[model samples]
Target: MAGNSDPLTPRAKLAVTAGKAVAAASRAAGRGSGSVIGGRVALKLDPDLLARLAQNLDVVLVSATNGKTTTTRLIAEALRAAGPVVSNALGANMPAGITSALAGSSEARYGVIEVDEKYLAGVARDTDPKCIALLNLSRDQLDRAAETRMLAENWREGLAGSKAVIVANADDPLVVWAASSSPNVIWVAAGQMWKDDAWSCPSCGGVMQRPGDDWFCGECGFRRPTPSWALSGDHVLDPHGSAWPIHLQLPGRANKANAASSAAVAAVFGVPPQVALERMYQVQAVAGRYDVVQFEGRDLRLLLAKNPAGWLETFSLIDPPPTPVILSVNARGADGTDTSWLWDVDYTRLTGHPICVIGDRKLDLAVRLEVANQQFQVCENLDQAVQLCPPGRIEVIANYTAFQDLRRRVGN
Candidate 1:
């Protein structure tokens, strides 16, 4: 019920007020961040609260199997060059959490939401966003979420006839298939790290032909689209053939690809590429991923990788051998209850590094490492893991719940 030109209905106003109170209480009680719980309460009272709060706002929905949180943060930072922006920057990418984020700031000019792959269609329908940035699609939480092609088909069907501009990754064939139905689409050549899930064509179920960086279906002739935005070594080539250098405090090529996509999404709002890149450089971390924190006189750098595709990209972010890597895994609900995805990741990349494993599924990771012929020690907790290493910078890569556990333990 914060004041706006188009005010919320009385019922929606009451719902928002109650939701805000619940969020405040939850935070005060040290129970949780309260976004999800508060949003659930609000929706139970007024089911249309999300739509009502999103009215008159330029919303951007970001979805992907990986990098969506960071990309959403980057996009939100760039959009701030225009006006006030509201975002679930803490990685709450669900309907309830998104609703709580929007309801909290009723007068914001924009809403940038990170949405789960399974929930994008519903959120898009409610928010009626101005832009939808489809980052990439791969096997993620498969025990809960559907297959990659099925998710892509849902996106294609859900977004059809919608007026939102689709900013999609040209390098990811699944993303291309998902965004193909949209009339207004801007394809950016954001590099894809894992191509295992996209081997077969979604259209004709034929083998996809990849010649260097290009991909085409052998049966139906569905081909990779020419991207308007392309990323070179350290620069992004805009549609006008202008090269803009992407210098970010965030490390890795994945971040550069994310920045390239963010610039393209911001362009739809009239924000220049250089300006967006400048703003994006200020973001040091997103929702504790890649956050460097001090714990027990040691610098612990936290990295979150939930799936095989994400783990492949995260492996590059780790420090070189002898730096000592701590790998943690969990099979909690947030993380799919199947640790079998661990076998898909090539843990042999950590060879020569002093590796330690810790989590609910630490034994599974230990077995995977053993199969890779990599030496590792299983530790009960982060404290024990850190004790094995000397007092210096240590890399801690963990799955979803394990990452959250470390964040709490390290006081991040």
Candidate 2:
């Protein structure tokens, strides 16, 4: 239970009251997740609910095609040193989730919220966050988001009028363009692993040059901006080239980049980069991501891989050589309902690892793995799939829905 000290008007209070009742009922009935419907009801009652609720609050907005949820959690954890930070803790980035978060803890003066890629500008306008962290952009849920550049273009328009200081990833070409015109910006050289969505310049359609870690366009002047903070090997280097060790519980180079970005944002509030990183290390999991749940009498480390880029980064975290992993792929609506992106990813990395595939889209994944010449066996059911693995610390990677289903199954 959180403190209650809302400054809302009588009408807004009534709307929120009704919304909470609906959310409680939804949770009791188990009809939906309750995050969206509660927000929907609140918005239906008061369309300007978020704008009104955001008054006098210090808010931070985190948006990206991937890692937004975990990044939001890290930033929120860091912000807690200052005071209580309200956020959508269930990995909900939509308006409803933000509403539920704000309405749930109206007393908190600080908020660390995750905004979906498409709705960043609008949410920023309404909530008017004190800082907006722009993480990397790649092809994710393209059926709903369209071209990856369109999101960057929207950010350009949406962030033009933003008064908040911008903390953006300079390593990503698309993010560089998105934060180009913004007046106040803190650039971080967080790595971009996926280059499929960045073949051409978003500005002039010119071929992008990847000389080394950064990128530049031949026709357009667009290029990776000089970063204020950058990841050097296993360390995060400041402008003075001083190295700070990134010892986070979240594994992989991508999480190091996320912690670096979070530290950059925390620095704006006078939190030392070292202090911020220390707090981030306390975070072992974001939602169900990176959780080691006991399932079917074996410890399963859960990895959420929603798209090609997500799979690439998540897979890199697994220990090298003979790593046994459970690969589940589901083409649910939340996962963009298209399994075609499976081909875009180079699954040959799993050649040495023992692979067991499951889920509704297991056949599609099996076909992909077979063509990639990876040795793997298919299991018809997840329960039976767990029995196939050795009884020990087995690693499990799944797409959006499959991951959530497993999380619920394991009671995480």
Candidate 3:
């Protein structure tokens, strides 16, 4: 008997098969493989399998160093406000994870995905998104990303010759430069007082200045058209939290940026500003990013700090005369085996002291803290650290793996 062989159908079958195989492989790696694939049998499908599942679904691919998840979710919600939408909301940003998401959806008019920077180009090539939202580029995951410039170049190559409308953050110098070469790009400028990192020519190494939230190359005079949609104001009255009101469900400057990016993406999809505001107010923080929890009669804040950029943003948001904190770091291969990026973080900002250092890499954290003149108690075990630390308004910083372990330990 001959094996099943129909070109299009077989391709579709292969996609399904590969997807299931990926999930199984992830489980075998000791990761929570089910969160995204969720009880789906192994099929080992390929990208073509998605074609069999649906047709004419608009794809929105969102990529950035930070804010991808929130922006993707907000955009998905805004699209959902218009009609039914499907997304991989489980922080699965790679090609396989995206395939799994498409496989699981029943009916979807639009598909919004948060893509990893390294995978963005390939995903874009394969998925052919209708719109690609490129948020600000920042230094993140040095071990993986290597450099922001390289990632930007990869994005440029990935997007070349594609008909996808480019929605970009104009204030980011790298994004501005990348979009300058592309026609049909819609720029979105950050609001007032938004301090962007890419303020100069990425190629010429000249200072790039923002004159009125619109970026222009000071030296080369390379400039892109200002954003069609811009988010500006003192306060947006986010019910989740307010800077002026001085209360936030998620505490940090980064959160504000995340919210702003979300709003911008929502606006691009024709969501009414008023409706966007209302929906944003109802927005809740995700599990690992500045999620406040009440555990054991104590208030605990879980802030995900995966890389140096994240660390800087987290540190900037924290108010200090020395708040008690639990800092966790891990150097496992799966959790970013390289820890050299620690040097890029300005640990001095966390001046006063940490209450405890938890995780397998406690000594490394302790040494870094002590070197920065910040006192800390080291605990090799996460459970021990949690038990020993007193409750009440505690801040916990954890890397990807450590964050997951801590969440499980705290039952969050």
Candidate 4:
């Protein structure tokens, strides 16, 4: 909560200048937006660059296993109702990228940052945010972060005694445990369709019993707290018992849950829930997610699902039957070199679609589909997959790098 007038030290000022210069040079070289490399240089010059850059701005840090980018974008858009907001809109959620983003926009009154799940605690500590949104935590990147419970514990410890208002999901046990340490919290009953990671209680290591919509640890007293905000179908039911209809350009119940979390955070900054929601409806897509592009007289809708939990959500948004579906995956660094997570996803849901597989890990995906008794065509790339389909709309579901590759090729 440092004010905007708080001047940066001489070293910090120099670091910011040098970082911006490197970013510009990187852009000229077409090495992608220089956010990460430039941020590294800045942090190297001044180790405290992120904290210094966050001074005087009302920061809102958003973290989740899924929907981090989309939720961050929604939060930023809702905050625009108050004043100018700056964000790392292109999925750069690490400390260095965050430093570069804040350093680049000094005039903005607010900062909305999407944080990688594993790095959320560090980012939260440095930013000292006005509000923090914990959407959900599930199994993601087994190679990198295998312990989801450890992540929840880190969140609980990192946010202990923080003054920020916590906007968290009441439906997810991992999120509930993580945000429970905070003194102030606004709980939202955002639906959790994938509950594989939260069966064991994080606090007591006991089995959680879900008799109905309520979940409680039988051994320990830890349970789902009564939600102040709840989602019923397409509406967001607030604490005041007023149900507001959520009409978002982004499809699925997942995006609606994200909007509910965003509206709750915006309320802490004096923006009304209705006003915040009104602003959020304008966000049709986050980066390339849900972006529809035309290629070779066919429409392709791009969806990014990096893990099993994410895949479950994306499956609900895809077009029903007869619609050709393209499944792509990669074992790249960004996509978590392990493709074993594919088995956890229910490929049986894609029963009627003419499914085509592509990417470096297409063979793995094909084998999984085959195990499910689902027929699929293995293709070399997206263009070949699209060629297999008739002239019409094609649904594309890909992991991190595969989605990015399709987006670039399709000019999205």
**Number of the top-ranking candidate, with lDDT as the measure:** 1
Provide the lDDT at 71 for model 2: 91
lDDT for every model? 0.92, 0.86, 0.67, 0.91
Candidates' TM-scores? 0.98, 0.96, 0.82, 0.98
lDDT of 3 at 377: 84
Shift of residue 192 alpha carbon in model 3, Å: 11
Tell me the TM-score of model 3: 0.82
User: How much is 361 displaced in model 2, in angstroms?
Assistant: 0.8
When sorted by lDDT, best at the front, the candidate numbers are 1, 4, 2, 3
**Residue lDDT tens for model 4, 26-89:** 9999888999989999999999989878877899999999999999999999899999999999
lDDT of 1 at 82: 95
lDDT of 1: 0.92
TM-score of 2: 0.96
Q: What is the lDDT of residue 119 in candidate 2?
A: 93
Greater-TM-score candidate between 1 and 2: 1
lDDT of 3 by residue, 1-412 (tens): 1122332466666656556666777788887755356323322434355434434467788998767876776677667776678888878776656767776665677788888888888777767677888877776655666677777777777787778778787667777666555566766654322244565577677877766646667787777565555544434332223322212255555555555555555655666545655565545676456677777676788888777767777776664745677889988765667676676677777767456888878777777777777767888776566677665677888888888888887777
lDDT of 2 by residue, 180-215 (tens): 878899899998998898889988999999988868
What's the lDDT for residue 326 in model 2?
Answer: 88
Clashes of each: 0, 0, 14, 1
For 277-299, candidate 1 gives per-residue lDDT tens digits of 99998999888888899988899
